[model samples]
Target: MAPELPFDDQEASTNLPLATQIFRFVVTGVGSGILDFGLTAILQYALGMPAGFAKAIGFVCGTTTAYIFNRRWTFRAEPSMARFVAVAVLYCVTFVVNVGVYTYLSHLWPETVLYSLLGYVIAQGLATIINFIVQRTVIFNIK
Candidate 1:
């Protein structure tokens, strides 16, 4: 049985349908991605920070945003320390995969704006797929 929620139905997060979950995940990811890119641009260009450092900071920001929204709306899971740890570990893996793809692509192509965006898209796409599968099947499965 589901645990009793000491709040209204609106405040409780029930497991959503698959279609609804995908829709929510896309929406949440896009929003987080925009913030990530914006922060990366600001840190790398405006502040003259290194790309690696700036991207690291941006990735953390974006991941944090995604986690908060995904927890509440996408998976509708009640928060737990174990869940948080699982997500953190997942993010660590994704971070390397995402950045590694982008870095390899950047090296292959000239450092043009188009290639940069292309690299970001490919890396982000891979990470998103991994994130959704792992989160739905593993971390958030209890919900």
Candidate 2:
């Protein structure tokens, strides 16, 4: 049987390039963003939740999906509940930021879906940047 490679070794087996890894990361990020936005839209439209509440609920769902996917596939990192909790706490802060933006935009442009979507994009953009950095550098430790 072939020898078992460490998680890092398995990650590098792609041999594609750093650019490829970053590209994959962005793709994964967009998938996670879709999850966030879909859930937010459903909660706000179907359930008639406030934009802030919908965004918070969506943030939890999206971040959980992101953590699981990034751990197993994107970063190929070992799992740790403690690390999950830490990352979750960080996500909560982002959730508040998201809610603030969502609420403001809902007020500013009460009649338009575009403003709500734009607010979500802005909030999620900041959260995604922070999530990628923290997951790669601190939580997952890709290097």
Candidate 3:
């Protein structure tokens, strides 16, 4: 038997379909990634900050954008304090996961642009998969 969704049909129907949700995720992620890379470049080059510090700033900005879009558009969940906390925790985990990948790649590549890019690619891909699973199954309680 199929499990009942927490939301009523009318509310659920208002949400985007799965394909639409994925499209929104990709669009939002690309926008956020651009913001991240821009900030990283400015901080690292213009401000003369270290790569790690610049990456930190970029990650925070990008993750903030992602949280807003994923919660409202990708999952279409109602906002609440508890939901925010749950999502925040998830972001924290993703932060560690992403930075760890970046740091590891940096060690291997030693100041190459590909190091940073590869780290972002792998970390973001993993984070996106985890976020979708956790948000739909647990935090939002979607069917």
lDDT of each: 0.80, 0.70, 0.71
Please list all clashing residue pairs in model 3, or write none if there are none.
Answer: none
Backbone atom clashes (below 3 Å) for every candidate: 0, 0, 0
* Candidate 1 lDDT over residue span 18-96, tens digit each: 8877888898899999988788778766888766677778888998999988887777888988888899899999999
RMSDs, each prediction?
Answer: 4.8, 5.4, 6.0
Give the per-residue lDDT digits (tens) of candidate 3, residues 26-124: 777888888887787688768888777787888899989877866666666667788788878988887777767766766677575656677768867
What TM-score does each of the candidates earn?
Answer: 0.86, 0.78, 0.79
Give the poorly placed runs of model 2, Cα more than 4 Å off: 1-18
> Which candidate number maximizes lDDT?
1
Off by over 4 Å in 3: 1-15
Q: How accurate is candidate 2 locally (lDDT)?
A: 0.70
